[model samples]
Target chain A: MMTVIYIVYSAVCFAVAAALLVVALHRACKARIAARSERLLAQRYVRMITALLISDEGAPMSRFAFCGRRGAKSVLARALASVSRSTCGDGCGVVRRIMAANGVEGWLLGRARRSRGYGRARYLSMLASLPVSVSTANFVGRYAGSRNRHIRFWAMMVRVVADPAAALYVLSTYPHRFTAYETAAITAVLRRGLLPLACYPLLTSPSHNLKALGLNIVRMFGMADAERFLMDIISDDADRDDVREAIFAVAAMHLPVTRGEIVARVRGMSLSERRSLCRRLACEGYSASVIMRLAANRDRHYMETLVASYKRSLVCCG
Target chain B: MRQVLIVGDSGVPRDMVAAAAECAGCAVVCVDDMAQAAADCKRGRFDRVVVIGSAPFFDGRMSVGQLRPCGLQRPELYVIGWHQSEHTVLGLLEFGVNQYIAFPVNLRRLCRKIGAPIFRGI
Candidate 1:
């Protein structure tokens, strides 16, 4: 019993010693972290001071950037990155400043897209911080359809950062696989301002994603011509749900001709088909009374799905 | 005398699948949607099934709502479509799908890709 107690005491002492050692090590780690952080901050402060002292040598961008200019930090950073690359410094460093002032967005974009080397990647990263201009936007466009996936993704990001209009041109031209990503970017561009009609064709493309995206653009822009095309496609297909989507598009348009056409078409359907068509027409804000009468007897194959969709629409919406 | 069933929606890729099947001199039964395709899959006396469509060739709006028919008695199935479904294909593959081909389907590449494995176990 005495021996066991002695062993237990020793084990407890060792555990306590280990705990104390861990606490000491933790304190040492914290001190190291603080010192490292202080050194990094001092280095940044020194760089800032040096940059300011050199600002008077005709360095508007680097000066403005050093002085913490708003709305152009990204641009200046881009310029600095570009001039730093491409043939070293020359002409009293004024040439270097001019290059910095000259849209780093373009330079980095150029390197990222066209150049292949370690230096180009550094330039690309520097340009990444700036708001891209038109030329930079155009440069980023080169990678929108890149065979390299990473290059394509970065190019797309640069499009959003650069001139958003140029980004639309890229999204409109990018492969079908990237449609969802393209739509999100293009929608942001549209939110900023209207996209051109040339972009309309891509919306209703055969690709499902593009078509869905097109439907959104059509909804947003209220383009009647696009709606007409939707109507034509819907009318040609015998598919009931597609036809419903078409009806919804027409109803969204709220055109007098479409309303009259819907009534006429609804009047022509057999009572069985009309049961389903009536609900769609009603959901489009026509009278639901006609649909309720026909719903007394609807097709068994469709009754569950259609009625559930119809009831859900009423439940959630109304 | 084993056969394959193909579900083709409107467009170029579908046509390409048809042409390749013809070139191989294998009989293929084609349909427009999953409902008809699934029905045919069960009834057609086939050894394999292939569905070729764009990203959502089998959207609920486009076909019967089922991913794989509960009563399917057909052969092994292969899908060459725009993509694997969000998560549905794993279950479908578990059910019986032999393969799932995601697109940007290059016909030449697909033919080359499948040239070996398709004929395996034959």
Candidate 2:
């Protein structure tokens, strides 16, 4: 009787193991099929984009049956999210950035938000994956203000390139902490376009973090075109010193300013004031234009720093 | 209106497109593959052909490579590779398709895709 009991127990164990193995195989098969579907979808996405990019003759292909694809759609959403993040930083791209910033981006981001189904998890993952900022500015700008976090992140990232003020505005109001991952998102925006940080059209931001962050961003801009915008916005108070410093910084970078104009403006200032102005420009990575003026005898204090700044500029630009 | 021959793979979004075409007053015939699609083309049953599928189907009604050489009686061909194999779909274009739509199709949008091209051809 004992042997009989032992045999029954052994039989049950074998059956349980077989059942578990079958379940495992089933899951593996489902996963593989899902993966292949994802690959196929991504291929379609690139093709469509390429076609859109190249063709003016044909109507855009718009018949996308993006419904009921719990598995495949989720995977596709994740893929799109990854592309956005790779292009921007977070999975968000232009449309989402704009939506968050401004509508087209909003709708898509909304879709990403509202998605549910077997595959919705994948969409969520992609939505969270923003691209690096430095690289993806222009791409996002094309569809700028995309509110979908992933797409908007890309667009905002691109804007950060040329105009960090806008990017910083997005970040400070970002509703979430900027993670290490988000640095790329920020850089992507900057790489696309550098907004004159000192002279953006921002109206009323509530957070000091936003203000301080905005100021820092205004300072980081390449200062190549800051001259025009700065001249326009050099008044009013928040940080007039920072703005003047920035102006001097731009001049010192040697961007293209009449020294007669700068000297004429500063003729009444003390020697220390003139030296500080030169140092500000030297530190801000201006071109040699400002240095030519400083190379004159009376303003000779910054001569050494200007030479080092010029060397550093060459190293940085090259 | 121009006619379109639609081939329905087992799992694609053919039904939606076909219904859309039919609703748009397009003379569309539904078939399963080259044999039937070709026959219909020969019989003056269709002016163009559209192939669509839903799930990943094995039945080979219209592989992109096979599209050009088949010498269908139809003047234009469109393939909707609902499953998203870009290489396969792009290959179809090389084979001389008017266009390829990704599926699960937005029927309303698809009607416009085929309709505009057909109208322009006229």
lDDT at A224 for candidate 2?
48
Candidate 2 lDDT at A45 equals 44
lDDT of 1 by residue, A267-314 (tens): 555675566555555554443443444343544345445555766765
Looking at model 1 chain A, which ten-residue stretch has the lowest summed lDDT? A83-92
Model 2, A1-318: lDDT tens digits are: 999999999999999999999999999999998778766665454333222222323332343344235554443344334333322122123323322332222333445446544233333333334332332344335433444455454444435543444554655665543443454334333432333433343312444334333333444443344455444333332443444544554453355545454455455446676667666656555545655465446656556656686677657543
Docking quality (DockQ) of candidate 1: 0.01
DockQ of each model against the real complex?
0.01, 0.02
What local lDDT does model 1 show for residue A146?
A: 56
Query: Which candidate leads in DockQ?
Result: 2
